[model samples]
Target: MSTPLKRPYRRRNVAKLLARLHPKGITEPFAGGRSTAPERETALDIAGALGAAGQAGPAQRLAIHVLCLRWWPGLFEGPSRVVGYRSVAPTAPPPSMSRSMRCVAPCTPKPALARVPVERPAETAAFRALADLIGSRLAIRIERDRAAQDADLIRHLAAWVHGDARPNTSAAKGVADECLHDDLAARVLAPTFLASWARAVIAEYRNPNHCPSCHGYGERLQLTAVAGSRARVDVASCDHCIGQGVMPWSKKRRAQQLVIGEHPFRQYLNAYHEGALALLRELEHRGAILLLRHLGSDLAMDTE
Candidate 1:
């Protein structure tokens, strides 16, 4: 009798056997096993756990997506392409034209960390809208003149929550100034009075010595052009005084002021700087929270 024929082992059967033996090891074999599905599922789980589901709308979804992007940016990667090939062959010319050029195939380009084209525009719009909404809710006027600064504040807030750098101090100070000015205006503080008050406070703390170049005037006039009968003059702030009209007070002078200071006097002088900083910190902290809330609501409305 002829010998029985034996079946050959195949990769498919081996893979299936492994998958059965260790179900968790292979998610899906021979089906482009690497996928973003797990990443998406994890994102959804995070969102749900963070109270982002249920009544959450498009704005909320968008905000969640933004957070997801920050965490797992690879999930949003676009279809990759091979831009160009590189030569792996020797630098010397081939012996014959018929010889094949030994070239290495190009790798699929990775998405740039800073470039998320599809969602960036929408993300920007969301931030701006959040800024505006937060401003409105907080009773802070988003003036057209300072719109750019306000937008920057919103961007900073977004960066902060996403584990990036904090907001710029100058930007925060600017916003604080605007808020203070608005509050004073609402109380019907006269502009001239406000200016005089600021000048008085500054003068009290400033060194008694005036800037010699400007002689107590912040600006100095310079002859710009000479015509036949008339001369053009331009006024510029004195570089030495930096437009303050007085020299900066020394540490010794500050100590002397403290020695003469009563409790009220100390508080008054400290308020000039400390009060503004405190206001800025509060605004930034509260604004960040409100912005995220508004972003979710807006995103939900958009989806509907």
Candidate 2:
């Protein structure tokens, strides 16, 4: 069979969007990259335009699908804090489209995370929703998938609850606490809904590389120009920052994180200490000494 025809560079809007969203140079996808919102929104808008123009092709379909965020951003957006994007192969390419290149996100301008938290409208809204869900008769069930996330979420949630439920309270707790709470509902969600806040915490603590630039995986996307036959999308890695996630330092920016005592993570952990101690005490109260051996080893090994 003959290969599919490639769009000419003059009309390669999808190609441009793909490149903008793809990693460039030698870095990775990051959440706060300057072009992230613009590129993503443009892709969706252009894809819609293509569909309206009656463009029928696999390339258009794949492009549109990639840009379409899940309908319920509020649901998964929370837990995704601890859990990064699931590793799914890029949506299968159309038979007509041949792979050409891959690049990280460095080509796009990145904002400095010097002393403030970036405003993520979608995530902020979700946290607000969670605050409301916590105390009312309303219920929203979400899963906590990983062990590390479980611990992290608990810490952030503890800070969130105690911070009086204000929006963008990262300065106080290193977590966004923008929720309207019901005391009973909060007690119900402490263990389960905590994962979503992990992302908020990460946004605050990310090092320079993972700072306002990365797509959270330490890389970005780059698109190769549409050439003779096919254009390619590449994923690139950040050479500046070695970490895959959060960091405690940033040499490039000459900025240092707040000391442990003043930092949000420290406060968040402290907030959770109360819940932890209470749970341990309750376990001790029940005389479940055998179970306490492993779980209660931290506060003390008093398995009596």
* lDDT (10s digit) by residue, model 2, range 99-195: 4422443243333333332333345553444333321212232222123445555666666788855533454343223222245235434644344
Cα lDDT computed for each candidate against the true fold: 0.40, 0.34
Off by over 4 Å in 1: 1-207, 226-231, 260-304
What TM-score do all the candidates reach, one by one? 0.20, 0.20
lDDT, candidate 1, 1-304, per-residue tens: 5322221111112222223223454335211244343321232333343354313566544444333222223334454555545434345543442223333423433333332223221224443343333333223322442466567667767776787886576766665554434543343234443333333322342224667887654567777767687876666778888864556544344435434234423432333423322333243333323333433422223222
Best by lDDT: 1
Task: Kindly give the number of clashing pairs for every candidate.
Answer: 5, 34
Predicted candidate 2: what Cα RMSD to the true structure? 25.1
| Model 2 per-residue lDDT at 268 | 35
- Once fitted onto the true fold, the runs of candidate 2 whose alpha carbons sit more than 4 angstroms away are 1-202, 205-240, 243-304
Worst lDDT run of 10 residues, candidate 1, spans: 5-14
